[model samples]
Target: MGLLSQVLLLPFAPVRGSAWVIRQVMREAERIYYDPATIRAELASLEEQLESGEISEEEFDRREDELLERLEAAAGVQQGGGGFG
Candidate 1:
């Protein structure tokens, strides 16, 4: 953009900057949410809760399935495939 174009766009600079920040935050959030280490730690904690009777067998089974699903998803994303061609 030329000087005049930049000057015209200056009025919208805050909106553009805010959008970029939001995108970056979402990317970081996704990275953390599917992190393997974080998932492993949570799985261990879940097991502890189950062994201590903090969670019933049914609930534990349900949560275990969810965690396993997340683990598989993270692996799939890392491998660039989800059992699909």
Candidate 2:
């Protein structure tokens, strides 16, 4: 590319930089969200809530299922090297 092209595109540099930062943030968020340790911590917390009656059995079961699915997916990713949903 010529210097003229770089000069012309300089106006959009901030926009492009912002977009890249957003993508990186999203990827990191996804990584943490699907992390096995994070999911296990949540499961433990959910159990604690149930024990303390902070959540009902029905609610615990519902949320437990959701968390278990996330764990299964994370395990699959670890084993088969897949991407997060």
Candidate 3:
């Protein structure tokens, strides 16, 4: 940016910095959320819960579907598609 523009926007620097930090955090969060290994671990945990009778079969099915969707979304992202949709 030009010196004049930088000076003019100096007052908003903190806000801009905060926004950038938030964006970084969101990107990291999404990375972790859609990670295949994480999803697989969760799926295993869900199975253990079912086996231990901690969750009903219906609950297991619902959660399994959700995890499978995450896996699909992760795969799509890896293939150059973006976002959950």
Candidate 4:
């Protein structure tokens, strides 16, 4: 496109990226803090994929546990008032 259009799009790129990041964060917050079954189901599917040779067991377990731990920690932090200042 035009140079002006490209320049304008440059600043908006980060905003768009930030919005996508926020969406993901919100979904994670909901899964970890409100509805945990989403995490469990995703983990189960990951484990199944690993069992079927779609992914390595080490990677699968590592990612699954990491997600679980992150969610649990987020839940704990929420209970702790989220360190608001």
Specify the highest-lDDT model's number.
Answer: 3
Provide the lowest-lDDT 10-residue window in model 3.
76-85
Badly placed stretches (over 4 Å) of model 1 are 81-85
The digit string of per-residue lDDT tens for model 1 on 16-78 reads 999999988888887887888988999999999999999999998999899889888899888
Stretch of 10 with least lDDT, candidate 2: 76-85
Clashing pairs in 2: none
- Identify the candidate with maximal TM-score: 3
**Candidate 4 lDDT over residue span 1-85, tens digit each:** 8999988799799888999999888877665543356667777898889889999878987888876986686577668865311
Ranking by TM-score: 3, 2, 1, 4
Per-residue lDDT for 52 in model 1? 99
lDDT of 3 by residue, 26-78 (tens): 98899899999999999999999999999999999999999999999899898
| TM-score of each candidate structure, all chains considered together | 0.86, 0.90, 0.91, 0.47
lDDT of 2 by residue, 1-85 (tens): 7999999999999999999999888888989988999999999999999999999999999999999999888888889877653
Cα lDDT listed for each candidate:
0.87, 0.92, 0.93, 0.75
Instruction: Report the candidate with higher TM-score, 1 versus 3.
Output: 3
